[model samples]
Target: MSMVRAPWRGVKTPGVLRRAPAMVAFCAGLAVLLAGCATAAPSGAGQVADQGFVSGDGSVRTWDPGDRDGPVRVTGTAFDGQEIDTDDWDAEVLVLNTWYAACPPCRAEAPDLAAVAEQLEPDGVRFLGINTEDEAPTAQAFERTFTVPYPSIGDRSGRVVAELNGVVPLQAVPTTVVVDKDGMVAARVIGQIERSTLESLVEDVLAEEEPTGDGS
Candidate 1:
């Protein structure tokens, strides 16, 4: 009979040396624990109301009504004859208000808008007036008379006013739009916003930043 080597007695076969179920379980548990320890997901909405610039109804609403809608890009020359690019203005919120030197309501609210601008500027809010009807000289004169510190964009084409709400018929003189830092329209105001109302809204928008921490 052929001499047959005795089966290896000391060494175990490959299949016989399988890992223990406990070891596999421990490894899976460890992986899960490590995954759980990773950074938590970001929060949806912060507690602060001011930081929340965009309205729930999907319309940009702000203290100054007569603000523009759609995109927040300010393209063109200001009434002061200064070149204005929405990018250059350093503010988290933009107030785009439409006005005409000839309109009574526009004249009445000019001071209020100016005051709003002065109060909110320190907190990173910009107010831009759009002189939709008047020529450069008239708009300049109006600004001077009202002591409007913020620059006014010249929308002589009536195109910008048409883009805003509550001014479709071209009946309303003062309409405004609030633009969030992302260049998105946050709010729209269709008429004159009282000084107090405008200030409160601006405060609300500014307050939103306290909790969100600049939305970084």
Candidate 2:
């Protein structure tokens, strides 16, 4: 809950896409949550919400080191036609975000994510996007508008989503998964994330000692 402004926090939103949803986006109780989520996303969220993807509450979740899953397996070409294979990345931490061109929360959080990627990429923390929808032009337009600094895989086939099923519930368009050095999911933000919250999550993982392979 750090209120510290990210260096790029002042970035402006486009006039046409400026409708931000409630920050308390998701209902907490499972007893009534599903019913509540049926409503349309924020006006700017996307025209596709009517087609049935649910928006998530900005809830954060994490796994203990002992219970993590994967050295995740997946790969695909990015919007710019760059072939990215996670297996080949020499990063200590990997941040994977599931997004699309027009999700409201996605647009709202873009600047925060851009700043986080800028601040962390140089330190070996890799940020990748698995765009759940959108053609390269729409996705690239979003990236250009937001000044996003990382490459995103064009996951139009849902191939990457299938590959990462248990590690992430990617049905939510703006979900973000933070993977540890061993490629196991360390934390997740189930909706749009606050910059400080994301920074803290990545910093927490970045601070951990590489797991000792002593079979303890």
Highest-scoring model, lDDT: 2
lDDT by candidate, in order shown = 0.56, 0.69
Show model 2 residue runs off by greater than 4 Å.
1-55, 210-216
Tens-place lDDT per residue, model 1, 46-130, is 1222422211111224433334233445566776667777678788787777677765556767788998899888889988787
Q: Which residue pairs does candidate 2 place in steric collision?
A: 26-57, 45-104
Q: How many backbone clashes does candidate 1 have?
A: 17
CA displacement after TM-score superposition, residue 37 of candidate 1 (Å):
59
TM values, all candidates: 0.61, 0.72
What's the number of clashes in each of the models? 17, 2
